[model samples]
Structures are given as structure tokens and as C-alpha cells.
Target: MGIIDAHHHVWDLSVRDQDWITGPQLAPLRRDFPLSDLEPQARAASVDRTILVQTITVPEETPELLALAAESDLVAGVVGWIDLTASDVAEKLGRLRALPGGEWLRGIRHQVQGEPDPWWLTRPEVLRGLRTVADAELVYEVVALPHQLPAAVSAARHLPELTFVLDHLGKPPIVSGQLKPWSAAVRELASQPNTVCKLSGMVTEADWHEWTVDALRPYADTVLDAFGPQRLMFGSDWPVCTLAAGYAEVVDATGVLLAGLSPDEQAAVWTDTAERVYGADRPNQCRIRRVSPRGDASLD
Candidate 1:
């Protein structure tokens, strides 16, 4: 059986600055983590296909990722960034779609958690960009901390047609082993059919030095309950997760988290949901080494 890692990042250290990794808590991730270091880990875990996500919101990074996806057979899709608040969002999105491996580009993401504005999603310009996203048939990757859950929830309700993927399960309170407000917001967010949850980035939220599957179960259980198997998909935050656990460990933790789900439910969470969300342009096949049409670059 194969797994599709729905979330991961690859960046060149020689490229533009990634200031976020310089912070004290994130010091472990200070170096460049390119695709070179990622291939072996993906192979070890049987992750035949992966979606290459952009690490920064800068305009150039999206095109760079698309270029990588163009060259790498393992990159089945890409969730690139776009400044959703820009006035010419539609034009910008159109340009991204016109780039090389543009077809590999599948979604939009913003660093909502980094924004000083707690109500960042409510910005008029941001909604304008989201409207453009729906028009372009792209998905939205929701990256937010626990405090930003309400903003994400609000965006989901306002743009019912847009496909929104909640990253890292909204970075729930796994470290403290509590699931109150996190569970509440997740349930509310999942109540909207257009929203889906990615079981990614759990390691960064847990006690990295002392994390365990038992500590992650409650959070995972809520996502499975709220989104169900049909709306859930697995993700390994990759190099970033490496700060706490290895790629195999992240994959195994997801396996442990979903042990009790039925076979069909397990299949859906592992493979089906991502196909339904980011895969309208292609067929859904589990264990595919690479998408068909078999081009080194996206011919779409």
C-alpha cells in the first residue's frame, strides 16, 4: 500500500530569506531543507506521491515550487502561496497558473498565524483574493494557530464554494494534552462541508522531547469524528517535523492515530479525500509512482 503525503516543504538555503526559521523556538530548522534530503525519507515510508508546499509567502517561492514539481516526478501536486490581500489577486493567480508546471499548482496558502491581526481572514482584500481562488478552481490551505481558528472558520462560511484544507489540525493543544477550544472550533469548522482537515504538523505542537502517540490520539480522534474519513487526509510536515520526529515516525503516528477506523475509512483518510479535494484534474489512484500523461513537466 502507498501513502500520499499531502503536506510538506522544500526550500533552497541559497534562495531568498526565510526569517521565521531564525526565531529561538524554531532554531532547529535554520538550514535549507531541499528535496535532496526528502526523497529517501519519502521512499522509506512508501509515500509514492507528495504535494510540495511553499515555505514562504513571497511571490517568487510559488513559481520556484512549481518549477521543482515540473522537474521531480515524486511531486504530484503543489500548494503554493499567494498574498491574498493584494488588489490584483485574480491577475496574480492567473500568472501563477501560466507558469511552468502551473498545472502542478493546486492551492493557495497564507501565513495567517504570523499576522498581527487576529481577524486576518476578515480583511476585505483577502476575501477578494479568496473569491478569485474559487473562480480559478484552486483549493485553499488554511495555516493558523489555535487563536486563528475563528478566522479560518469565518472564511469557510463566507466562501462555501472554495475547497479549504485546514493545516496541522489548526495546531491544537496537543502539548498540554487538552482538547477543549480546539475540539470545539474544529467541530464547528468541519460542520461546513467545504472544509477538510489535514492530519499534519502534529510534532511541532507536541512535547518534541517527550511526545507519544497516546498524546496525539485525542486530537486525531476529534478530526476523524468531525470530518470523518471522507473529509480527512494525512500529512507529514516533513523537514519541519524533523525538528521533533523523523518522517517515518510522523507516518507511524498517523497509523497509530487511525488504528481503530474501519478499513474503508482508513483508505479514505489515507488516499481518497485528497483526490476529491485537490485532484479534480486527474484520476484518483492509490500507490501511483507519478501521475499519468507521464510528462516530466506538467503538460496541462
Candidate 2:
């Protein structure tokens, strides 16, 4: 079975600044982090293919990611960003899919966590754009914070046709070690059959300097219980996760968290869920092959 990393990111600082990396706490991500820098670590962790996600809300970024996916065997798909509020969003999505590596454009995302309004996702214009996304057969990745989850739930309920992939378990408050509202909200979102979640970004959300797998277990278990293995998938969160743990640490930590599940259930987290959700099993994917260093077994 192939290991499909459902979420990760790459950026070229020299080409354009990731304005979000401003504070001293985020200084480590200041340098250029292209796919070349990530490939080695991903290979070491046995990750064969990845979904290159959007970092900024800029439209141009999507085309670049799509082009990168077309050229790189490791990047099977891209979750690009678009202006959902634009009147011509459907036309713009069509234009993006018509680009060089258009087929690799699998989904669309916005930094909903950055939005001040909790109900932003439920706006009429946004719902209209989401319909366009669904009409094009692309999923919409929900990048919201815990407080914004109710709106996410409402949006999911309103647009049941759109498959909403929840990123980072709605950015749960793990460091605080409380799970009241977050747990209830998560269950509500998961109740919608169109929703799924990625088990990623937990390390960074915890106390970056002192997070332990034990501290993250509760949140992971909550989502697993709510979404189940079939709707849950593994995501490295890559360069962002570097702020707390390296690629291998994140992978190993996920293994520890999922150790209690049966092998078939674990397989869904490691591979099957992502492939089925993102349609990565499609024939057009490049399917990069890498041999585990311990032996010559190829993950082809």
C-alpha cells in the first residue's frame, strides 16, 4: 500500500515572502522551503505522494503549485487557494484547471482561521463559490479554528454535496489541555457525512518546547472516534510542523497514537483514506517510487 501524505506545504521566500512568518517565534520558517528540501525527509519517513497545500490566499500560488505537481513525482495533488468571494469564481476555477498542470488541482482552501468572523463560511457569496467548487468536482478544505467550527458545520450541512476536509482537527486547544467545546463541535462537524479530517499539525499546536505524545493523544482519539478511520487520514503538515517536530518525529508520533487500532484501520489512516478522499488512485498520478533504506522494498 502507498503512503499518501494528505497535507503539506512548500514555499520559495526569494520568489515571494510568506508574510505570515513575521514574529520571532516564526523566524525558523523565514528561509526558502522548496520541495527539494522536503523530499529527502519525506522519503526517509516512507511518504510516497503528497498533497501540496496552499499557504497564502493569493490566486497565483495555486497555478505554481499545480505546475510543481505536474513536474514532481512526489506531489500527486495540490489544494490551491482562490478568492471564493469573487463573482467570477467559477470561471477562475475553470481557468486554473485549464492550466499546464491543472489535473493535479484537487481542492481549494482559504485561511479561514485568519478570518475574524466566525460565521464567514456561511455567507451567501461564499456558499455560491463553494457550489462552483463542487460543480467542478473539487473538495473544499476547511482551515478553521475551534471557535469557527460551528460555522463550518453549518456550511457543511448547507452544502452537503461538497466534501469538506477538516485541516488539523480544527486546530484544537491541546496546549491548554481542555476539550469541552472543541470535542462537541468536532462531533457536530463529523455528523455530516460529507466531512472528513486530517490528523496533522498537532505538534505545532501543543507547547512547542514541551509537547509529548501523551498530551496529544486525547485530541487524536477524539477525532478518530468522531470521524473514524475511513474518514480520517494522516497529514505531515511538513514545514509548519518543523516548528515543533521533524518529519520523522511526526510520523513516528502518529504511529504511536494509532498503535491501538487494527492493521486495517491503521492502513486507512496511513494510505487508503487519503487516496479515496483526494482521488489520488487515479491513473494520471506520477506515482513516485522510493525504497526504504532498511531494505530494498519499493513503495511503488
Summarize candidate 1's per-residue lDDT along 39-83 as a digit string, tens digits.
888989888788888778788899999888888877888888888
- Return the clash pairs for model 2, or none: none
Estimate candidate 2's alpha-carbon lDDT, on a 0 to 1 scale: 0.87
List the candidate 1 regions with Cα displacement exceeding 4 Å. Answer: 280-300
Against the reference, the lDDT scores of all candidates come to 0.80, 0.87
Per-residue lDDT tens digits for candidate 2, residues 129-201, read 9988877778889989989999999998898778788999999999999998999999999888778889999
Clash totals for all candidate models: 0, 0
Q: How big is the positional error of residue 202 in model 2, measured in Å on the Cα after superposition? A: 0.1
List TM-score per model, in order: 0.91, 0.94
lDDT of 2 at 73: 91
